[model samples]
Target: MAVHHPATIVPTKLELLQAWVPHQPWLGGADVSTVTRLGSYRFDDPDGEVGMETHLLSTDDGRVLQVPLTYRGAPRVGAEGSLITTMTHTTLGNRWIYDGCHDPVYVTALVRAILTGGRHADLYAATDGGLVLEPATTHVRGSGSWSSADVPALTAPVVSHHGTTTTIHAGVRLTLPRVLVATTPAADASLSGTWPGQETPVVLATVDGSS
Candidate 1:
């Protein structure tokens, strides 16, 4: 489950994304003002140290983008290049945000979820009384593992940007589609999800890993 604190963030998520997304090489020079958030999903950090979230956005010109982000209490040691922006949370104090692709915690959770047939993390709002379930706006699922052993670590992912796909090499290869499509080609493993207006599941990412 993911718990959301009812606190104010100095630079809201959208605000930070606006200032950051345009600089991405794959964005085709689209600015933040033309971006619209379609939906999002979350993954839980078993250790409860990092906040993992993925947002699906669309450009005015009809290009879909998948952005995964991780929020941590302190700076991620060697991820200076992936830092999005820092923000002050009224209740939690400070938060350091980074592109999830470069964060091991996020990469592990994603790989584990795909290998274990895990679903998106359920969300809850922290209220004065207690935690209240927040209806998930998106639904996601992954193909489970074929073995019982723990998922292996992928030291440092080497990323390659293509026109419509972003490939990451870290022992295993992960392909994330930059353009969200209704129908997906066959893949070795995959993560898929559905949103409110879109009843059909959209392929989020595909994995090619050795057994």
Candidate 2:
């Protein structure tokens, strides 16, 4: 069964956003005055420790942006495959939570859900054999890359002061916490350097899982 995490105690989506939004890089800042749910998706982890939620947010304009996060109570042992590294310190100590989605099993399940038309995607599995997530409110689809159980590609780029253009190369140091570069033919990697104030993808994508 899918498990629910502490976040479920949140009485409203806004409350949850208020608590979790500032911690994420894509959420803009602690001063965010407004947030409207554009669209969202959930995934069930077979192991059940980490809850994954994919949310799309935007300003008053219709331009939508995506934020995929893995909510974990704690971190894993020697979590080398993690993408975004972040931790919150509670009164007890540090509540270890990073993007563990690169774990092969985690990636596999995400791929499966995308391929199958499952009715519910609310599920999470931790590396320590713990599971949590609300099991009844979500489903998932669209599996394209299942054979290559490789780590998600990582690109290093720094957003311009205006947050439009990004400089990229092989070893450039990046200031962002995590950038999910989608690998495929369906991903629109068509970036624009000539234009300012344009929407550059924080999550670079592939169209057909091609490199």
Candidate 3:
């Protein structure tokens, strides 16, 4: 389960995205000001050190963009290029934000989810009463089933972005589409999701063994 705090955060997620999205080459000249959050899902870090969340956004031009982010107490080694910005959380203090594609922890979670039939982390609100379960607006599931014998092992990963897709080369290749599309190629392992209006499951990420 993923516990969330109601504390205030400086330079809110929207503000940070507004500043960062306009510069990305994959946006195809879409207006950043019109960007709005459509839905989001989270992946739990077993060690509970990092906050992993993937945001789904929509623009006035009818583009749905996927942006995965990770929040950590300290900067990730060798991921300076992926740093989006730093922010202060009223409860958690300072946070270092990075694009999830370049963060090993996030990559591991994605790979594990794809290989182990994982689902979006369940959400809970940290309240004075207690941890209260919250209904998830976005849903996701992996196509593969857990198999202790077929565990995925991710080593040093090389990440690159091409057009609207990002690729990560490690023990397995992970392909993530920055822009949501209705159709995607079948892969050895894949994660698919459905949002409010889009009941059809769309492939969000895929993984295949290294050749």
Tell me the tens digit of each residue's lDDT in model 2 across 26-145. 433323455566445566666766666655454443344444556565666666444454444232233444342334333444434333322235455433456644333222334243
lDDT (CA) per prediction? 0.82, 0.39, 0.88
Residue pairs clashing, model 3:
none
* Poorly placed runs, candidate 3 (over 4 Å): none
User: Could you tell me every candidate's TM-score relative to the true structure?
Assistant: 0.92, 0.43, 0.95
Q: Which residue pairs collide in model 1, if any?
A: 115-145, 117-144
Per-candidate clashes come to 2, 34, 0
After superposing candidate 2, which stretches have Cα over 4 Å from the reference? 5-33, 77-97, 100-106, 115-139, 143-211
- lDDT, residue 177, model 1: 78
Q: Candidate 2, which ten residues in sequence have the lowest lDDT sum? A: 187-196
Q: What would you estimate as the lDDT of candidate 2?
A: 0.39
Model 2 TM-score, 2 decimals = 0.43
lDDT of 3 by residue, 1-211 (tens): 8999999999999888878887876765666676889899999998999999999999888888999999999988878899999999999999999988888889988988888999999999999999999999899998899774576677877887788888999788999998888877656689999987889899999988872
